[model samples]
Target: MSEPSTYPQPPRRGFVLAVVAAVVLAADVLTKIAVVASLEGEAPVRLLGGAVYLQLVRNPGAAFSMATGMTWVLSLIALSVVVAIIWMAPKLRSIGWAIGLGLVLAGALGNLSDRIFRSPGPMRGHVVDFVSVFAPNGDFFPVFNVADSAIVCGGALIVLLALLGKDYDGRSTKEKAKAGSSEAPAS
Candidate 1:
């Protein structure tokens, strides 16, 4: 009987990535719709004893209300992120990366959709930010939405992976170094 190769193919991960992205996108979109419908003109809904607040905020800017005048630029950046994630999906081999990228993809897509289709015009629309922390109307923490949260979490995960030398190809920096050293010709 033939022995198995030392390296096995990476398990199917694209599906997991796609599913995560789809679920997050759906959730963010649905929640935004619900909030817009119910809290458009109503007062902020305090939850968990003022720890969280929900209201309607059409923010034409980046997270924390930054760059309020660059909605169109933000839209393009988000669109680019979406395209980059989609391009990288087929190459994803690590489950961690899959989830991380999935979250990022969903975030970019969610906000991109809003910036493209929401009020104002195409590529210049405001993002639907309806969640605030500490106080209503972003008194403490800027009002943000699901997309912003996902982006932060996912980006952090990706950065952590990089710092830990974990590659999306399921190899570590040490492993790559060892392989390279072993493959070198004797002097």
Candidate 2:
């Protein structure tokens, strides 16, 4: 009698995720350092004919400048996110999920590091944001950093994958059903 094959093994998704996360984290930290060193309270640099600009802004809240003045609370939240990502990262079987989680992890760590070490008290430090986009009018988009960019891009990818019906274990619903049916005892 022939032995049945077990469930499909997960590809090298975790390794790829780890590499991507490391790159993102390094880029975020390095860019922040360069911005701090070069700008140092200087004015915003205009680019693309006022469509985009780089201005140093310190944010103590979450995305889009919401929840201002809640540094400690946000810090705790970000820490929790990081912990969750680290825990789930090892279990990720889908490349899509791995990439998504990696982005979230990198972003959380990037900001958390700033909150812990960049001036002010612990969990009270401000995140340095510099990239800005403007509308045709004088209105400006919220300033963000490399970490934020990674998080957004990763999130979008994950959402797209989910919409296509990919699961965390990297199996489609039909594939899972087929596997289950094959394992059932004969009538």
Candidate 3:
């Protein structure tokens, strides 16, 4: 048999990561388009026993409308996030990490798309946010979108994994500790 390949193999979970990112990005973009087309000149649509409201709101800033005049800055930050995730994908050997990073990447790309191609020009374009929880016009909570939800969920998963000592490279903190002990210098 041929000698084992010296090249490092691609991440075992890379496929899963790609699929999750694609699905989330598609859903976010589709939902935004649908909401804009349907709700532009209409009243907010209430659903789930008035727990959710669908309305059209274009946000030019970060969460809760912070930095309302800095859409370009927000766009830059989102682009950075996208770049970082893509760079780290090859090291995502854990399924949990892959899924989490995929969600984050999808979210960043979704919002970045808005910033790059939406109204008022590139890098200064507003993000399309439509989902309002509990009340319309963001009375009860800030208006959000599918991308925002994905970001929140993915961030929570990452935090949980970190707390559990699981590394994105498919190793546990405990495993690293054991390996370090084996390589310790003798007294």
Candidate 4:
């Protein structure tokens, strides 16, 4: 047998990431379009005995409607996240990391598109939120969209991976590599 190859492998091309991101972006945009077209002036459509509902709302701020007067700032933050994800994609070799980054990219881009093209103004436009979870009595989770869900899931995945000691480039962690340490010299 030849000597073991010592050359480090290049990172993966992140095709899975690309595919997931594309799917999420398409879904988010299409759903938002449908909601805006059909539910702009309609009442909330309750489902599952009020456990779920569809209510179109425009959010110009972050979670809980915070910073309503700083929509431009939120837009900039979304834009920065998109750019950072793109920048980091090339270095991602693990499927888990790719998936996490892809979801984040999709979420960021989905909201960023609204910020760029929705009403109010460019970079200050409102994000279209629907798909309310739980009751609408202001005692449960805030209304969110598919993109928001993806972001949360993706972020959770990334955190889990980090806790598991996974590397973005898919290399074995140093501690793991040394786990089988042998303090003996070979003849």
Q: What lDDT does the true structure give each of the candidates?
A: 0.89, 0.83, 0.90, 0.83
CA deviation > 4 Å runs, candidate 4: 1-13, 137-139, 175-187
Better by TM-score, candidate 4 or 1: 1
| Candidate 4 backbone collisions, by pair | none
For model 4, state the Cα shift of residue 170 in Å.
0.9
Candidate 2 C-alpha lDDT tens digits along 1-187: 2246566677747787788889999999999999998877787788899888777778888888888889889899989988887777767889888888888889888998988997777899999888888742124678899988988998888888878878767887677777778777888
Instruction: Give every collision pair in model 3.
Output: none
Clashes within 3 Å, all models in order: 0, 0, 0, 0
User: What tens digits encode model 4's per-residue C-alpha lDDT throughout 106-163?
Assistant: 9989988888898898988898999887875234878888888889989999899988
Model 1, C-alpha of 182: deviation from truth (Å):
2.2
* Arranged by TM-score, best first: 1, 3, 2, 4
Ranking the candidates on lDDT from highest down gives 3, 1, 4, 2
lDDT tens digits, residues 1-187, model 1?
2333366768757888899899999999999999989998999999999999999999999988899989888988888898888888888888988899999999999999998999898988899999999899999999999888889988999999999998887777787787777777778
Cα shift from native, residue 49, model 4 (Å): 1.9
lDDT score, candidate 1: 0.89
Q: Largest TM-score belongs to which candidate?
A: 1
Scored against the true structure, residue 72 in model 4 reaches a CA lDDT of: 86
Question: Compared with the true structure, what per-residue lDDT tens digits does model 3 show for residues 1-187?
Answer: 2344343544578788899999999999999999999999889999999899999999999889899989999998998998898888777888998999899989989999999999999999899999999999999999999999999999999999999999888878887687667667778
lDDT of 3: 0.90
